[model samples]
Target: MAVSRRKFISGSGLVAASVAAFPHIARPADAAATRSGQKPSKIIHLVADGMSLATLSMADQLAHLSRKRGLAWLNLHRRAGAHHGLMDMRSLSSLVTDSSAASSSWGSGSRIVNGTVNILPDGRELTTLYELFGQAGWKRGLVTTTEITHATPAGFATKGLKREAAESIATQYLDRGVEVLLGGGRKFFDKTKRKDKRDVYTEYRVKDYALLNESADLAAAPLDKRWLGTFAASHLPFTVDHTHDTKLAKSIPTLAAMTQRALEKLARHERFILQVEGGRVDHGCHMNDAAAAFFDQIAFDEALEVCLEFQRQHADTLLVITTDHSTGNPGLNGTGLRYGLSPLLFSNLLEVKASFSEILKKLSPPEERDKKPEPVTDPAKIAAIIKEAIGYEITPRRAKLLVPFIKKEGEPIYNLMNTLTCQLGQLMANYTGVGWTSGAHTSDYVPISAIGPGAERFAGFIQNTDVFRHYTNLAGIDFRNPESPLVGAVSPDSGILSPHWMA
Candidate 1:
């Protein structure tokens, strides 16, 4: 259990700094045996979609800025408690990997073409690991702050059409009989909410099978998984917004709650695979809101705590924490902000855009309503709203910069806000001397930290596809048709194999 990589951490920097710091990670020893010789009975994969090295760095800086001690990923990395290693996250595209390809990399073990999931770059479809796990008799679950049917979770759970089909994904979870399905996105399940307006949840709850809308939900039996629930929609409310709305928060549990119930339900099977994603981290990062991103990661960190605690009780579990890709690549310049401001400490950029746009809409004269002062990008007006709702102020210069980017092409207000948020995190950092770049997904190998069975196999800079091989091999699943070159793994150790360590 002793860490061997501490001495290598000489100075502090981003990915480069830690790369040298932990040179030799302790390989987790092989897990216990079932009827066959395999790694372990449980594997929990925690994917923070769109988490770039910058996201990791921002999470740490945000935690430190907001409070004294920060999150465990930073705290544990700081002290080398968990298994820390880099994962080379390249897609078959090899340029930039979207969530579909990046998550598909993990889902299929082969890097698929950019826009598809579980299918190779050549359009060959592979059965997703979720189905594979189900067939293998292992309970599986997918949890997200976004719709449970979103790209990251759905990539593993089902396949069809494009990632755009949220309704179909919702049906997949129910049809697949996944033990736990938790997240936001009420619209897709509510048929009536659509122009089609089919209330899928009410239908499912009412057991009115005649009204089943999607292909997947037709034959669905009523689910009574004690520890699980599902909501069908695209995105969930932020923690800040959750406080104001009871229906949103009360209707669904937090990611931690889902994970806990998942462990409660799925762990009983003796072998299970669950993927918990803090999907909104990418959203917050996209907007450049450190506060929202930070807290969400904390919410994710809370899930991590639930997992780590659960791991302590169930040693056979291999808990792997990593990201599919990086977004916005936000960061601080190591100066300014006597205190570090976390990425989560952000105002809802969407709210500002909505409010500001509303003010603009009201401003147009009735006679000339069609014409809209190029829309007041006034920072003062923005500051008033943000200060009240989010407790932050924006200067006129920054507010003015927000207009052109947000209003053009009739873009969704959230997109414009997300764009400005990136600026906001950096701008806030400047008061104490912080700077950052605009949004761009980085092609960087995310940090893949593991802490149980088959974990040693994850060490070092391995290709994205390699993860598929190792996870399937350990979980008693199969790889896709296209065989990838084998990347070597670190030998297993006691920590991962310990009977009580369920990650």
Candidate 2:
């Protein structure tokens, strides 16, 4: 099942040098363990996308502050048989990895460019984990809070030359042999919206895949057929907003519910690989929305609880939880008033009724330039709206700071929203001690934790690509073998399958 591409890695000078200097953290001993002929029946790889140590800690703190308990992931270390480690999530092209390259590292066992998924800079296409597992008789599936064709999930299933070519990626999954695919991006598959105007939902239905558009459909889908669920036109609603809105709560399934359904469907197979992603954690971080990010983290942890329950019943299952990279670099800074941070500061997140984006969409001035701008909304009303959306009280001074942007006739709505969100974030930081470095991913190391057989191989410091090495070895799949024959795999250089392999 090894990728047969000519593996010339595409990365920046720093990444190349680092690769040359410190090659292997530790070659997984699971290769020898595989020779013992005991492979897990299933491998559940769950990613809380764009989570850092600080993000993890904040999620734990938020959960504790609201409920009287710690998250399942937070308490994983206390379990008798568990392995935890930090993973270097750098990409081939940059120290700070994007979702595409971060996932490419794990999907292909090779570093790729920052924005490419499994496609090398030299234009080589590597075989993905989904193809490998599928060819080797394991059912493959994916679930995410992001689009199904998003880089993180798509990295495992298909070879996309560009991450934004989501329509093509959606088409790729139509016959990729994936048994279960669920997430957002209904636009990518809708015929009218697709650039090519192909009805992808119909294509999937023709292939006998059960198409699900709502929470009830996902819950009621039979396990006998493959499942395809797209719950949103874009990325799924942020957990915080969804939790508070009754209509969205009814229409969109929780990450845990999707994970549960995926597990139930895939459990019927003798062997399976299902990757569940808390993908919106990254989006929330990118937008600097703490309430959204923290709630999504908790939701992902709830998904982990489902995985842990499955593992308890099925001993031959490996459950690995990690993040692609850290986003925003959010951490708790010391508050001058308190000797130590207080959980009460984070409890305000519970009162947030909507996402900052939602609030902005509803309250911002219209984008049309031709129409004469209407009178600006009153400052007091604006302040009340912000407080209702984020639980951040806008003092008169803070209201003064936002007045110009709100009243400006020609300013883009997003600019005003960004300012408001940032101001609110700062206010939260003052009280809660939570602060963020930037709106982008950072070079900080991401954490990895695993339980069940071969979990020991994941312990200690490891490169992100080591995840591919370890998983394949644990599954007895020789990802290093260059001579293996692959079906439906296109050559990186030629962009065509070999004639002999086709036969």
Candidate 3:
């Protein structure tokens, strides 16, 4: 099926501009020949975690404006033989699924509860796709912008009751013999940072894994051995910050670099399955940082380009690109009379230099002796900070509205939306023409784009749990995870509990 580009761009002028700017995106005559009727020997699953449809649209717009090209993922929609569809990402416990459950549904062929990885609510452990592939002698790999042990990657290989168990999850990756593990969470492997003081790094090294801690190491490292790399104590720096800081750019590899390296290492094996995640895109959405989210989405697209290039050379590979679920429902709103100013306002996103998290640190920098930094309540200072970081000038009155929340003086109205980050996101929307519905996951049908062998299996509407079956079938494996009787049980009236902030 030909994926539609109608929703991606409206005017013919913009389409022509996109094609002219990125002429290499045009499909080659041999592209159709790369699609195979036989089972795929390799699969590359790419996830832009927490990406809503609007997020993808805005990211494409941003890329056209800044990079002079449309995103590779969106470009795939224009390919004649590619498959495009929507996926229902609801979990067993709730309509709005978290990353763990969303990925678990795909990983285990079962709708597991939120906050859990590959374990049913009733405590039965589901066999994950990674374990099955490993049993069949296929090399496995995971790459992400978040901690390698984060929910999305962990959902594929580990069985745990809590997604927060990073240390345990890291250990599981080593035990499962996943050939390539890249991304952040240095604390999970460093003895000094772990709760139990166990050096998981040493364990990997002892097992002949090539441990990499810096971006430079990745280039020189041999691809013959198992690889484990961690570049941050927690999640890697947001793309916005990483782009601005030279030191960070040198230390941390981009998502595309990690994906390329992972594929090179895995390609050495006869068969392999790799999962690449732009995990921090979800973090950016949760924090309501438009530039952060969009740039990370672009970073995810760069990785998509790497996968596409690999598939062009390797016909037996299956490539499935999708998100776990939607978060924040961020969109560029129509601005001014008849929306004449919408494009101009949306273009202001180019001026954004830092994420809300980085801006907050500057606004409330810690004092000596670890004392909490006093909020910068001065409207002039606040306006100055906003102007410097976001390149938008706000009136003193508008700046003052953020004082109460920043100072923690009292709970503002609409407690959830009133967060300092959310308030900042709202304030910036006037200039950027971006707005967020809520800083939480939504029960929306996310888009799926697939190509190469078995790509047709993902076309049309499908449940999230069905992905596991498709993947297993493509790999010539037949196994069904035990289902919990409580599947589809309505969650208790917890009244929209705040997301586990760090997850």
- On TM-score, the leading prediction is 3
Which segments of model 2 are wrong by more than 4 Å? 1-37, 365-378, 403-420, 481-503
For lDDT, the strongest prediction is 3
Each model's total of backbone clashes: 43, 2, 0
The CA-based lDDT of model 2 is what?
0.75
Task: Report lDDT (Cα) of residue 163, candidate 1.
Answer: 65
lDDT of 1 at 285: 61
Model 1 over residues 126-167: C-alpha lDDT tens digits? 777878788888888777888766778877877643566677
Compose the digit string of candidate 3's lDDT tens values, residues 112-137.
77877898765688899999999988
Arrange candidates by lDDT, descending: 3, 2, 1
Backbone steric clashes in candidate 2, count: 2
Worst 10 residues of 2 by lDDT: 1-10
TM-score for all models, in order of appearance:
0.72, 0.83, 0.91
Candidate 2 lDDT over residue span 401-443, tens digit each: 6555445432333442344455545555765567776666788
